[model samples]
Target: MSDTCSNVQGYVDPNWPRPDDDGSSCIIIYGYVPSFALGVLGVVLFTTALVAHSYLLSRYRTWYFSTVIVGTVMEIIGYIFRILASKKNPYSVAYFVGQYFCIVVAPVFYSAAIYTLITPMTKRIGREYAPLSPKVILWTFIICDIIATTIQMTGAGLIGRAYSDGKDPTTPNNILLAGLAFQVFSFAVFIFCLLFFLVRSRNTTDRHFKIFSTAVLVATLAVYLRTCIRLAETAEGLLEFLSTHEAIFGCLEFLPIVIAVYIFVYWHPGRWLGSESIHKKTGKSELEVSQLPR
Candidate 1:
């Protein structure tokens, strides 16, 4: 037994017989089943979202749906890496990097799509109600998303470097927490802005606009919930219960995102807001002025 332990060194290889609960080697022992299950579910949801976005693109010819598609693809790949990580080699550095990198940055694309929605919405309603012009809002929020993405990806890279060097990941984890907090703040401000527009708009009778706005609200809330969870999880540091526990991750991160993706698909703005025919026929001057990208 001593010979086997010495020969294996510090690594936990999945091909070898399972090792005893030595506090130093294994991060998780029996939670692979649940991880695999959640990973599979994530793949399925993201794939469905991808297909839906593709169909929307072919019919609507909107560039914004492509952003959602990119996010879905990232999510699918991220979960695939998580499934690999669940195969008894939870300590595998490759799997860890793949999962965290893709998952953490994927939502930035979704936020970009959300930001695009505001342009047409402000045009459809009234530009006066918005604090900034639609084009300004679009660029501002998308740039914020880019900054958040860079911060989170840098933190993930730092964490990977620290892991490889056998150093403490606390600093990188704090960086990740900052990125998550930034996302939460951005989404919160976005929601407030949307609410302000909703309250101030005189054209509330448009059912399609109302439904589209509701969908955007729900999706934003879902992402906001996930961001808050990630913020709390990372704020607790890598060794804490929220960071180590898989079930909590599945509930907070995975579930909220899946819900958000489905909401966007079912209530896709392109279906209503992207229709050139509807825009042309609209008697309202404000809605007529609203132009979706071809």
Candidate 2:
């Protein structure tokens, strides 16, 4: 605690660099002060997501959507911590780290929500359109998500320790980057699957497929935008321009995550994937694919 460079101390001083650091800059816990207004905006955005998701879950009973709610709650908690730190205790490491990683890993939960839709989507459109089985695709992304979350959480913990002990955070930062990198690669493969499915299914004329596909594409891309930015920011490390810049976090990270969770409000899975939906659309049953010749 005493080692904090200012309110929090820099491990590297620009004038007198650490043994390993380049002399160009220093590393500190927070590059700039946290903003109360931004934290409030985060809470408002996430709370709106929570309410919308909860309403959808209640009305449709798409229990899978609960993952989306869980992520929203975590985002709210993260913002609460941020709000507390913004004015009251900006230098408090507990609030700082808590706020940081909560937002960092919460995406994994909602990402799972999106990932699970692959099976239902394939069933609606036709399994043949995809190179891999929908279930296989679902499990693949889920497993990758679990691994990414684990790695990121472990790295977050090490980062806290690094700050407290005033030790080198290079290893922890690398661990975090590795996890984000893995997630990015997995998501890239998902984009391929989406595009492939769209191309193969383009000839089929199912209204539900169009809505479903568009929603999935929009939601997933929103998350991807946030994740890519996070990877860039973290790559810059603590106290660096990208890391400390609130504007980037608010505009890119928070906005995208909020958009991701809310997109489903209009495109709720139950509308297209529910048993009743099939009857509504075709007066039959759920139709992820074309009707068979009877």
| Best by the lDDT measure | 2
Against the unseen true structure, what C-alpha lDDT does each candidate score?
Answer: 0.73, 0.77
Model 1, position 229, has a per-residue lDDT of 82
TM-score of candidate 1 against the unseen true structure = 0.83
Per-residue lDDT tens digits for candidate 1, residues 1-294, read: 334345432334455544353322333222233378888888888898899888976766667557888888999999998887666457555567778889878887888888888776776777888877888778877878887888899998888776655566779888887887888888778778778877777365377777777888888888888888878878877756776667888888888888888887777766666554455566233333465344
After superposing all C-alphas onto the true structure, candidate 2 shows an RMSD in angstroms of 6.3
Q: How many Å off is the CA of 228 in candidate 1?
A: 0.9
Clash tally, candidates in order: 0, 8
Taking the tens digit of each residue's C-alpha lDDT, what string does model 2 give over 120-143? 667666788888998888889989
Clashing pairs in model 2?
Answer: 4-9, 5-8, 5-9, 123-288, 124-288, 124-289, 125-288, 278-285
Off by over 4 Å in 2: 1-28, 275-294
